[model samples]
Target chain A: MSGTPNQGPGLRYPSNKKSIYDRNLNRTKNAELSRAAFAYLFIEMIAYAQRGVSNVGDLEQKLNTQGYPIGLRLLDLLLSRSSNPLASIRPTRILPLLQFIAQTLYRHLFGRPADALEKSSTEPGQYMLFDNEPMVSQYVSLPRELSSLNCAAFVAGVIEGVCDGAGFPTEGVTAHSVGEQEQGKDAKAMWPDKTVFLIKFKPEVLEREEILGRGGG
Target chain B: MVVFALMIISKSGGLIYNREFHTGLSKLTSNDYLILAGSFHGMHAITSQLSPAPRIPYITPQNNMLAPSPFPNRPTGIEVMESSHFRLQCFQTQTGTKFLLVTEPQQPNVDTMMKKVYELYADYVMKNPFYTVEMPIRCEKFDRGLDGFIKVRG
Candidate 1:
């Protein structure tokens, strides 16, 4: 896999040191990763993060922190790997940023777009990203003692990291288990792992979004 | 020489996993297997303490980013046990999960196989979010991966 940097004859460059920057992220944009492999690595990451933690809350926090840097790194790689003609332009508005996450980022990570996106009815600077059955939380059955713990907090951290990296500067991002209540009791059996990621942006971010909206950037 | 069986023992001397790959040896009852795992765990602890390696003093330079530890502490225990018919290899991870692979006596490159198994365990078993620690592993993906690796190599 570690071929020559520039696509040419396979010439030996033994003396030169290879750097991460020298690699092309765009080439692997179409490449698919094994779900099992990803799951295993993710599980190990959770286990590793769980070490030296007191409670489930702390464990979730550790997982979130672990995913934060990945989100930051992915932001740059995703932008660069975009096939769109306007790929160079960063997402300036809240809607576009959220769309980028829901459609583009979600597709790259989980091989599908997010289920739904909505704005808060009563609250300003608040957006909701919904997933009927969040991939990360699909198999996780929390014990009664640690019922409040949501593994998707790591995913929320990733979203926060991406937003912050893209200059959104969100106040905080959190994943809440809405479960099957949203679909109502009468509805034919649906996903029990329903989750809504509440994204609350900083006041400054909202102000910037308003400016960007008016300017039509 | 080929691997006949694989077992995983939890830190508390519980038999978390037992799988037979080949029919090279007589099959032990589940109860007997559990007893064997428990006894092995106890013996491993005793052996580590019984034969302690002399400590060597070393200093790590602060500026050396490549050096993780100047004096790396090694896991002390019986690693490989060879018998006339079958050779048993024991690999205890940093977290104290024991992997026991039963192979034919003259199996070559068993150490490499053990290392590969450890890598697979770290990836498929440890990384799985649904798998509870020190519990029986029921991950289908882990089983499939192990099966594929061993089938191709064995």
Candidate 2:
């Protein structure tokens, strides 16, 4: 889906340059992957994370760390594909930035917009991202010791990655169960039905959120 | 391939899954469903224990619950649900986690479905950093995949 970059069309740019556009050619339409391979890979990832860590947070941090680089890389890649390309994520305000993250980043990561974007009524600078069924946690059931942690921390890491990759600064992203506490309220969160991604910002983001609030762009 | 029905039972015999992919199987109450899972789990356990071979007396050194599965190579707990029109293939993970796939009696292949379910579990729930093992499954991807997979199979 790569169109010619802003350098304009038809003026032969570096033919051998490693652009995202160049890489899209390799993904054939019928490049179906074997599920077994993915399972083994994921299994190995869990096994590896289990090593050298005594606590669940440490293990999840490891996973989140693993996904961070990919997130950062994807940020630039996704923007490059956009028509205006956001020009380095200048959201200028919290609302714009949050909308961009929930809409753009979610699309980049999950192939669709997030199920919902919300702000905590009681708290400012706290944002929540909702996903009815996070694809990453489909077959998993975690031990109780780490139930408070969200594996989508990896997704949070990715969002963190993208935010950090851009000029915007951020704090850690944590995953939570936003699923209805009662069953049948919405059966989706029954096991891991809903994922509430908590995006805490760095103080700088708050500072910027205010500065931008006063037309200080 | 067509999977006719599927069910999941927790280690404690709680009915965690009850799905009918084919019309052959009869529906029952939630309590009956729990009873069915407990009965099957008991039967499976009994069959394993009462195999013709004598029970090999063995003592463990203790404190090794996570030891490599003793039944790794042996035919572990899994079976087929047979009915007039279809077969329900069952697969249980080594961690006592089980998956049931309902398929047409004459379906050619089911290895892919089982593997795919496990894969989705790993990605959506296990990888979910939020999921805790050995508890109930609540991840949406797993449910969605199960629904989609069975719908097409049916």
RMSD to the true structure for each prediction, in A, is 11.6, 12.9
Return the lDDT, model 2, position A162: 68
Predicted structure 1, TM vs. truth: 0.56
lDDT of 2 by residue, A1-217 (tens): 5875667566445657666656653242355566445545666666677789888788778878877898788766666656664555455566776677788777655566888888878767788888877756544555556556565666777877766776567668777776465445647435444788887777888887787667854
What DockQ does candidate 1 have relative to the true complex?
0.17
lDDT of 1 by residue, A1-217 (tens): 6754654566544446555557665775568987666676667777788789889778877877887887898888888887776965788788888999998888888889999999999999999999877778644555456677788888988998899899988777888878555667643145556778999999998887788778974
Candidate 2 lDDT over B1-154, as tens digits, reads 6566667666665666566665646768778877877887887777656655545546476744556646644445447667887676777777676677767777876877788777766666655543455566665556677787667755
Model 1: colliding residue pairs: A40-B127, A43-B127, A44-B127
Candidate 2 stretches with Cα past 4 Å from truth are A1-39, A85-92, A143-149, A179-191, B1-154
Worst 10 residues of 2 chain B by lDDT: B69-78
Q: Give the Cα-based TM-score of candidate 2 against the true structure.
A: 0.54
Model 1's number of clashes is 3
Q: Give the poorly placed runs of model 1, Cα more than 4 Å off.
A: A1-25, A185-189, B1-154
lDDT of each: 0.81, 0.67
| Candidate 2 global CA lDDT score | 0.67
